[model samples]
Target: MASPRALPTPISATSFFQSKPTAHSLNSSSVSKNLSFWRNGSGLLQLITLGSTRSRSNAVENSSPTQFSSESSQISDVPILSCSEATEKLRTTRETYESKQQYLAMYSSIFGGITTDPAAMVIPMDDHMVHRGHGVFDTAAIMDGYLYELDQHLDRFLGSAAMAKIKLPFDRETMRRILIQTVSASKCRKGSLRYWLSAGPGDFQLSPSGCHKASLYAIVIQDLSPSDNKGIKVITSSVQIKPPQFAVMKSVNYLPNALSKMEAEENDSYAAIWLDEDGYIAEGPNMNVAFVTKEKELLMPRFDKILSGCTAKRVLVLAEGLVKEGKLRGTRVGDLTVEEGKKADEMMLIGSGVLVRPVVQWDDQIIGDGKEGPVTQSLLNLILEDMKSGPATVRVPVPY
Candidate 1:
């Protein structure tokens, strides 16, 4: 078995939950609707499945909403709007594009500037990414008017582009600025943002030389509702993640992850956890896994077989502080067997979008009485508190 990373001290359950800030006053209903639309209809999920048959037909025959007044003003030249103005603009846009058809058209207009009918958007008959899966992408959450960890995400995005041998035209700083501008243009404060860089329209051939320049697009989406934060049940699937040389890349090739998630859903689970060939826990479809032992040690898989998640890194840092205080034992990331995870006192999954979600059950086995474990809840509280408190560094204002 591969040795685990050097362990850090453990954290106490009390301090973890005690530090979290109270929830913000955002509208829960609106957030839910927006999340559903973005996650189910937009390119986020489509990139994984490679196509969305159901949404394509609805996208057709819909006119793009006249949001933003077709103003050709550049972001660098335009003045940034106040929070109130941004919020009002977004509300007006949502009201105008209430129908699914209009929303699809609006998505294309605002994100990609592609005016094709919605039906044409999902007609997977084209080879683009669906047929050959030649693309790379990254997603980051916009919280409290700031894009969280965008620089880190961009680094990972560039790595994925290199892995796929895709020539991304935009430099990191330029792309970051564009992402912030896109968010400001959408007037979304607390939501998600996805940046997809795909090999330009290509033929059915597998070679990258046939593809033209890469295409970049971004979309701002609403945040997850509190209801989704209640915690979720998970199922361990027989499907295992194969260790490819490109395992670290978050490329468009996600069939394994998709299939694993589908299997979990079929078994009535919210997410799927896959094991590696050696029967060691790998990770969830889109999140990193973490567990707390009875001795209060934080455990996770080493980065060798899983994506180095930004949220996971932050959590580890928080855990380190707890260890320093001698509240818990330590943090460990290595090959954790299925039996070890099942036997853990607490378990949770972390992601940029979800933050931290407790796992009540793994497969049929109840993990720590099959409810939100005390330690898991504590860690989540700590993370929430950290997010609510602004970062120490001064935030660079987003250019309109």
Candidate 2:
């Protein structure tokens, strides 16, 4: 893996303040004070009353209705509500506010003062991994208010950290507690959680010994909607994956993966499939690639260059049934040519985001009938069923 780059700058959530204040009294000192406080704080006071009717009535009478309407109009532009929909608008606003507050509370509870932003939490740069890209991360889906495969994901994360010589700040059980607390606090029962660790900030040198501390963080993101599962096109990239010395470890250094993804995006494809230095098939930028032969064998590239994907492992387990029934055969990683993939009976990319989406096209060549093939469809169904039931114990479930 390449050395880690400077962490990306954090993104803010200030767009929520686009709404203007609604029509309310500001003539009296109390009303003015409330308005001022709202402007500085949450601006809730602007939508509510805080004083006696006499004061409010006096402020309303003295205030221009036109001005109130104009202010209300500006606030109405928020797209959340209109003056005619004040009651509903207020309710929605409160709900949104409460949700954000809950998310923050959860983050604080998990990592203490280490972080608070639920979007782009940061670990200091002095950590060894920050300077050397010596840590790992794992993410899993949350559905119906329950975290999915929390334990399995954490196990992978810890293993990667150890591979890079970074120590975990907490044990598996402790980390699980923090993850649950963070997820619950965020009120993100229906989202994805990204749990990552970094060799805590250290000197600017590449040596791992300089890094004494490690940082762990979890981010809860909105879940993928069904609409997002639509199949995507992919293109083969000229870039080759540098075979990892520790192919099974998931590390922070991902420039090669990022570059491959950028190539796919630039070409308007869903993903980029890479080749190895030997001109054999490797994998997608962030997923495992699989193809079904004319003989109905399920073949995957050996773990030579890409990280071993948890989703890919699950799919392999599910394929065992088919293999035993003589419906399919399982083949391990080996050199596979691009021609083989293009001419296969079926092909699909599996990962956390893409799942088991069939490859409708590879570049301009149509894959199979240029639609989802039987093997791809069946595998997708089996994986979905497994996920819905619960984590597959044969497969690891990282608890958080």
Candidate 3:
């Protein structure tokens, strides 16, 4: 019989890492640094070895091959973490990085409660909304401890959910209370509240037939950046617009809109304007497009083929005041052509995010002397004033 093969010597985790040959040690330096950093006096257990100490020697030998057997073998040192380890890693990772947008609070139906910790403000990986894009969402701004257009945005939110066939997790009143309570928990005075309705957590699949139930999630974002109403440029989008059926709902399927926005940025423009199938002016990626005609008439595209903007509708109502004051001849919502829009006296993009942003140029054509128009300025001022001290119908106080 052949002599018994010599068993490899058992090695501790630290020694195993140090003994790796330089030629095969592609990530040895990073692994050593990570080990050093994590092995500090935290009293945490060292990396666990699989099987018995003697049998694991073979595992170590197999893991660190003489040479990389495949591209994936180059990553052999990755740790298999437990659930608690993963959670701790997530917390530390979040603590180590800086984010532009600060999330103050989050409410999730999955846990049936609110959380102030950003690390805990996570959705389930298997949630249909997370994996499959089967969700609808809406937002309302918080001004002076009050939610602006809460009911208006909430109505739109429910409407979008209904259109998407996602049932409500709770009644509208309960959701409203939950949202207010979430903002209250955050103690955020000047920010925005965004919420979503989805088919809930389930296995990863194209259909929601396997979902357990519907879900609702809300988040309060702290926004301290001052608003800038300066004029911006836009380009005609090369990306095709979504069909009217999908465009009319505020669903989470915004790939086309995102691509159009990216195309605009690639061309040194602020937004890309989409045209309807019939080639009429549709809207911006996330905002509605409006124009001031040569006759001083405020014109916008009909909402039948695009997302019905809350801010745009409010602006339309507020424009009536401008009309009464002779600032505008009148306000009209209908199909508008590119020639009609570009040749107009002024153009503006209206949405909750942008409020009333002036458009200085469309493609190469300058809009109305290439400056922010008086109408756009007045509109932005009107919106700001409304948010600060609007009627009870528009602003809902958060009883924190």
lDDT of model 1, residue 253: 78
Per-residue lDDT tens digits for candidate 2, residues 1-400, read 1112321321111332344443443443543433221323312233434335677656666667687767555644544322235444544565665342233322321235323343324345455556677778888766666665666677778877777777777788888777777676566656677777776665667776666567776776774345455556899886667567655677777887899899999999989998877777778888899998877888888874667778887788888877887778765556679998888888899887777988888998888777788778888888777766755552233333
Give the per-residue lDDT of model 1 (tens digit) for 184-300: 766666767777777755456777566555667666666444536666789887676847455678887788888988998898888898777778888898899999887889999
TM-score of each: 0.68, 0.66, 0.83
Give Cα-based local distance difference scores for all models: 0.65, 0.67, 0.86
Per-residue alpha-carbon lDDT of candidate 3 for residues 140-207, written as tens digits (9 for 90 to 100): 99989999999999999999999999988899999999999999999999889999999998778899
Q: Which ranking of candidates, highest TM-score first?
A: 3, 1, 2
What clash pairs does model 3 have? none
With candidate 1 superimposed using the best TM-score fit, by how many Å does residue 256's alpha carbon deviate from the native?
Answer: 1.9
- Candidate 1's C-alpha lDDT? 0.65
TM-score of 2: 0.66
Q: Which runs in model 3 stand beyond 4 Å of their true positions? A: 1-65, 69-75
Question: How do all the candidates rank in terms of lDDT, highest first?
Answer: 3, 2, 1
